[model samples]
Target chain A: MYSPACKVTDIASLIPQRSPIMMVDDYIIEDELNCRSELAVGADNMFLDETGRLSVEGVLEHIAQTAAAHIGYLHRQAGETVTLGYIGDIKRCAVTGPLPAVGTTLHTHVTVISQVGDVSLVSAETSAENNPILNCRMKVAEG
Target chain B: MEKDELVKKMIEILADEFEVEPEVIQPEANIKETMHLDSLSLVDMVGLVNEEFGVEIKTPDLPTIKTFADLYDYVFTRM
Candidate 1:
């Protein structure tokens, strides 16, 4: 069992997302290059599809937020305030399995592949109940 | 690696990655112009070259590598 370094209650302070849009609920950092996050899909989730499952866009946002959380954690450790970030680009995104339904929890892992200047390239994989759901590479830039 | 082999490999790799024709990647042509590289794509190019050639391109050294020939020489000496 991997215990989260930051709980859902404290997530908002780390990442710059507010209500309805916030996708991550828990976060754990394995190292400077790797981190994991969790998102519990609820009935009121804004990105739910017509079939009652989380949408692909929702999963992508969750992965981006996971990367944001990693950068935010580093900023906090340096006594700096959290800065806003944007997803500059996404490549090689694929839905590998069924999307998670409401009441399911999404587990996401992020690896920082490289960082050049303010842009960080990261690879992300998300799974639900041990079933792989999505994988992609994203360029996240601090704004 | 020999300079000729390095140039051939670089052209093939860069052309494929940048979605350009190998014919357009001339030795004296400006790399950024030929590849249509923005900052993000330039980073991608750097990462790609690093992966392929095991040459770590420092940020400060980027401006000196303006053409395919420069990039070839850079990697050749480093490798």
Candidate 2:
């Protein structure tokens, strides 16, 4: 039950996502190498599958945005604006449990594994209602 | 670690991660060419080495390490 340092209203200022596609609603930076975020699932969410559960793509996007928010926060701390970042690669991605339905909140934890140049490797774990849902490593490059 | 032991360990690690045969990792072979690595995949290699050997491969030093022998030397000296 980590408290969010940045609320839904401030999410837009940290990451580039906007509107219906925006996944992260709350964010918290734990330290230089770790962060956490949450996304509240809604019926109108664009990423829901026909089975009425959040799709795998949605989960991956959420993880990616969490990493984006981490990078965004660091840049802001350095007195720089958030830069566009691309998903250079994803590795060891696995769906570990059931997907969330509307009304559930997705909690994600991200750890910075390494960074060389403008590219960073991050490990992400997402859970829905305290049940582990997804885990993966992502490579994000500043664009 | 001894150079022979380090070289043996690196080959097993890199070959498995890059999905190549262990025998293909010759000392004088061009690492990028043998591994078919682009800029993005090159980062994967760096991460693997760091994780397995605890050696941080600096991005700027990448150009200096052209062959498998150079990579072996880099990790051996650092370890």
Candidate 3:
């Protein structure tokens, strides 16, 4: 039961974060070590800076949740329960461009660089319509 | 790549990242203590390996790797 694509509802079932806070919308399962997710920026986005744009932290959380979804997908494929995971550390984080405008669709990509015991190091990047926005490497772990 | 070549290349990569002299890195060297690699640098090291070797190193497996020789052996087997 490998679903190549997932909707928002499917994302809810896979991850612990709920709406208003959950940044990921749709995801494409590239493989066990990689995944791509979509986030539709809107005024309703929870973490918007004063300019009515997604805050930098929001973008980072989107990247983190994308990694979490990848882990959840792996567990699902293995017939195990999806557990809560936190972003333990973030390294080499860089925001290259301005925050995407409302109604824009951000494409996020994450790769699992390393996984030791409870901690997994992941590299992630977000772009809107081929324009790079931000990228970073994060350490994720189960709670 | 031969073992010696692999070791040389790894040293070069690490030296460039850690801003240390390549000659200072030896296969028997303990990267953390010798190179003063903090936890963040260790994460960056994993990134470097993934970029150069295209192999994803697991954190759980990092414990088994301490010295440059250990890293070389693990990476060599994967390569």
Candidate 4:
């Protein structure tokens, strides 16, 4: 059975997003085992590329942020406030988008591959209009 | 390692990072001029360089990287 939607509020509540650096309106998909969500490219955000479009790099960051939200949601669900974390490696990353363009929303998904101690290797994919925007293997370090 | 070898590696790294062909990378070219990479990419490249060569690459140091040769010489020397 599919689980109920978990509201992922502001990016600040999850990660350390300095003003203008943070992307995503809210992340709303996460669990101990997996994570998925969607975020829109608003008027703000520094990821605008030379084409003045929301960039593939920005999409990668947005998806990574969504992954962080999953961690935060799982923690909060268990009565934890927040935990420190960082993306270890963004390997095998691929992107296909005009990027930095408005009117685009990315559906970000992350699945846990393996967890050795406090580090988790996540398999991630983000799509827009059912077309892939980015996919990568990310390592997460917890402190 | 030879500076030429390092330059080749730097070019390779940029090509890998941008998913482009190494031939497209001008040895005497400005990365921003040919490639449209952002700051985060620069940071990631620095991390890649540091991890591969055990060197500390700061953003300020990026200014010295004009051509593939420059990148090769710098990494070969300091890193």
Candidate 5:
């Protein structure tokens, strides 16, 4: 069984990313096909632009990392190494609101739309509170 | 799936995703070279296989695949 709440320190082992660059704080696998993750946006986040707002690319990465975390959690459960995964492509990405500010909690939800041979196409959306922030379809590849 | 049927299905997927005629893809045709597959299209191919066949292809293994026949054999063995 997997815990719903994960410690921030354990995020690193689930994903290949490290601090400052790692956007997700913790995550939960809701089921076999869906996962949810959250990040406490801070001034130290590397994706902040000159305006101190998270860039569009940052939002995409946030969603991608959440998906990665889900995959990682499964790998760990199977007693396998968490393999490296890459964002093969991003499509239909729409930023609907102002970039979230520091101190805001970003909640990301990812659903596996399809998966074939180490490649998965996922639909992801991010929100702050009930307000929608971004949505997109992403292709993830395992390496 | 039979070998011939599998090859046909893979070819159809490749043709549809790449926007090429199915007749263009031969068993020995180099997919990347003949289809002019860009990096993004290559990723789409991976996603297609995963969704259609329940396979999980890794990027490192891509280098080993040069022809449609090679891809077919790979997926066939795994299945």
Candidate 6:
């Protein structure tokens, strides 16, 4: 069983993320409820140009990674280390342009929706700076 | 409205989108669990759902479905 919630900032101590892959900037928790957080997009990846332009797929990946950030936090609170897990499934992928930012600060929100076996399903939505960007269903597990 | 007919349609659509054969998928088969469909394949599966069923789904909802029965239920419910 996993702990109720943990601060996103505290999770970095438990998970391994270097530069570009470390998208989540920080996390916020209040009264044991995990709420808003921010994620930063690196200008260095090929998927994202210095111009801040990116492919729809790139936008989708960033959103997916942000969802992973929440799972990482939950794992740490559970007294377990983050483990390897695939992206699992992405259903409706809709994107308009490169994520509009030379660098983006995305505010991410995740809510528990369903659970199957050991996997916990969460629904996520994010906005970069101030614009709504993407919505995704996420699944997390530990091996 | 027929489950068998819908399954046949699903088989044809899956084969065409995933570039396999209709016979390759059986009622007992699971798309991701048995067919070895990765994330990219799941994206294509959504496209197939859009084309075949005219239902719009987010990429995340696809993974929530664990079995053929779940998917069939989802599609039928939408229609």
Computed on C-alphas against the true complex, the DockQ of each candidate is 0.40, 0.48, 0.40, 0.02, 0.20, 0.06
Give the true-contact fraction for every prediction, in order: 0.14, 0.24, 0.31, 0.00, 0.28, 0.00
Ten consecutive residues with minimal summed lDDT in candidate 6 chain A? A27-36
The runs of at least 3 residues in candidate 4 whose Cα sits more than 4 Å from the true structure, single-residue gaps closed, are A1-3, B1-79
Worst 10 residues of 2 chain A by lDDT: A1-10
Tell me the tens digit of each residue's lDDT in model 5 across B3-77: 788888888888887889999898899989878976656766776788787775677788898998889988888
**Tens-digit lDDT string for candidate 3 (A42-143):** 789888888888888999989988899888888888899999989888878889998887898999989887765656788898999899999998988877
Best-fitting candidate, scored by DockQ: 2
Score residue A44 of candidate 5 by CA lDDT. Answer: 85
lDDT string, candidate 6, B1-79, tens digits: 6867787788777776676766767655677855677644555566467657876555467676777777877787786
Candidate 2's displacement at residue B45, Å, is: 0.8
All candidates in order of DockQ, best leading: 2, 1, 3, 5, 6, 4
Interface RMSD of 5: 4.8
Residue B19 displacement in candidate 6 (angstroms): 18
lDDT of candidate 5 over A27-140, digit per residue (tens)? 877777888888888998888899888888888889989988888888888899998999988887888887888888898889887665676778898998678999998988
Candidate numbers sorted by TM-score from highest down: 2, 1, 3, 5, 4, 6
Name the docking class for model 3: acceptable
What TM-score should be assigned to candidate 2? 0.90
Q: lDDT (0-100) at residue A108 of candidate 2?
A: 95
As a whole number from 0 to 100, the lDDT of residue A40 in candidate 6 is 64
Q: Which stretches of candidate 6 lie over 4 Å from their true place?
A: A1-7, A30-34, A96-98, B1-79
Task: List the candidates ranked by lDDT, beginning with the highest.
Answer: 2, 1, 3, 5, 4, 6
- Provide the TM-score of the second chain in candidate 1: 0.97
Specify the poorest-scoring 10-residue window by lDDT in model 1 chain A.
Answer: A1-10
Question: Could you give candidate 5's fraction of true interface contacts?
Answer: 0.28
